[model samples]
Target: MNSNKKIIITAIDQRSTVAIVFQTITIGLIMIGSAVGNIGILLAIYKTKSLQNKTSIFVANLAVADLLAGLLIMPFMFICSIIGDWPFEDASCNLTGTFALILGAAGMNTLGAIAYERYCAIVHSMVYHLKITNRLILIVITFIWLEGLVLSLCPILGWSEYIYYTNEYLCTVNWAHDVSFTYTIMVVMYFLPLGVMIFCYASIFKVARRHLRQLAMLDTLSPPSSHNQIVSDSDTQPRIENSARSLRLKRDIKAASMLFIVIGTFVLCWTLHGCTMMCLALGDTCPVDFPEYVYTMTTWIAMFNSVCNVWIYGMMNRQFRDAFRSLCCIACLRSSNTQVIQI
Candidate 1:
């Protein structure tokens, strides 16, 4: 009996050890991947003049939020996962939690902002060109950051509270601290933004489809013999207007399609975390035995949003891919020059 008991205890310890190892590996990948992808996005945008536009401005804001999560919060979350304790002092803990929350709220909102920008740029290009200025976008971005600040500081200022959730190995806003406040945050900070993203993307898709149908009609009407026809025949004004509109419509479709991919990825990554948080908010207090690692894994899954945005940018946007390739080419050339100098 004694020998059997010893064997079972050893098996349990080994299982626990394996679990921790797996958790560490998972969190490490998320942390490293988020950092690398986000930094690359920033660098690629900075080096490419074509990408330095209004759409990219919103993306840059989102990147800043992800960069903060990777650089500041993720490492600590990883450390806590490994050690199973909040080793830092109370102040650092509170401040870090607040910072993460604010950035996260800001980042998520930035996605909505991007969606809105795309909707305006593509669905109403003429209006967008006339009314949307760099100064206006800058003001909007400032508002986003300010909104995040207010949401994050609310907890610190006693509207709600944030504390370490050991199960997830990160400090987050207290789910049950002030039930009403938690519900408010979940709705205002998360749901509304998600809805806006969905609506904007859906509207963009509708517009794109309508445009495609129009092009198909145009293709049917166009004659093969007119392939070399001049864009402006005798009515120069109407022809020029139509030509410009066609060009703007095509640009809008491409831009909107790219951002739609990004918003889809965001929805996928965030859904799991949102559902879990929703359960907590709704008072799901069943005492059923659940795997201890599940919550932490869910949180890790959310961290992947930071990682996926970069890949989405690379995959969905031609300009982004070209920018990345050019940046890599420059780096390679620099390395070769250094090698030649050494030789």
Candidate 2:
């Protein structure tokens, strides 16, 4: 009996050690990836002049938010995860919690803004350039950051509160502190932005489909010899202009599709965390017991979304992919040159 008990205890200890090591490695990778990926995005946008456009401005803002979260929030959480406790003071906890909230709110708001931008560019192409000027885009981004700052400050201002959870080993807004505050965050941060993204994407999709159908109808009605026939200069000019417009429309649709994927991934990664928080805020009315690890895992999952956006851009956008490739090649050449000089 004594031998069996000793074996059981030893096995449990080994398992715990393995779990810790795995978690540390996973979190460390996420932190490094998030930082590197977001930085790469900002660099690509800066170095590639073609990428410096109205849409790129919003992309850069999102990158800044994710980059800050990766640097400020993830590093502390990584250390605490390794230490298995919050080793910092209460003030540090509050700071991290507030930053976490601010970055998250900023990211969601930026996504909503991007969706609206795409909607206008595609659905209202005639007025898009006149209405969505660079100056206006800058103002919109400024508003997004300010909105995030004000909402995040609410907890610090005593509307709710930030507290360190021992089980989670990180500081965040206390969902149970005030149900009303929790609901407010849900409405402002999650639901409102999500609604905007959904509505915009839906409208964009409808326009794209209508364009496709019209093109198909035109093809069906046109004479088969139209492609080969010589035409007058007057007719040729109009055809050229129409062709240019169609190409631009196609490009816009492709970009919108990629952004829709990003939004979908964000929803997938955050839904569980959002639902869990709502339940916690409900308290007795919810009456569901959640394991401490669940909280930790859900938060980590949401944080991982920051790491995904850059990858999605690199994979889906040709311009981004080319820029990334060029950057990587330059980096490799620099490393080789340095090694040769050292030798």
lDDT of 2 at 291: 68
- The numbered model that scores best in TM-score is 2
lDDT of 1 by residue, 1-343 (tens): 1211111001222237677788888888888988877887899889889899888988888888888898989888888768766777777777887888888888888888888888887677669966668998889889888887888888788886777776777777777667787777777667888888788878887887787776666545553335576654544554455556577667767776777677677767777777666555554463433355556667887888888877876657888888878888998999999999999
Per-candidate clash tally: 0, 0
Model 1 local distance difference test score: 0.75
lDDT values, one for every candidate: 0.75, 0.80
| Poorest 10 consecutive residues by lDDT, candidate 1 | 1-10
**lDDT for each residue of candidate 2 in 121-198, tens digit (9 for 90 to 100):** 888989999989989998988988898789789987889888766555567788887888898889888888899999
> Could you tell me the TM-score of candidate 1?
0.85
Query: Top model by lDDT, which number?
Result: 2
Local lDDT at 57 for model 1 = 88
With candidate 2 superimposed using the best TM-score fit, by how many Å does residue 271's alpha carbon deviate from the native?
A: 1.2
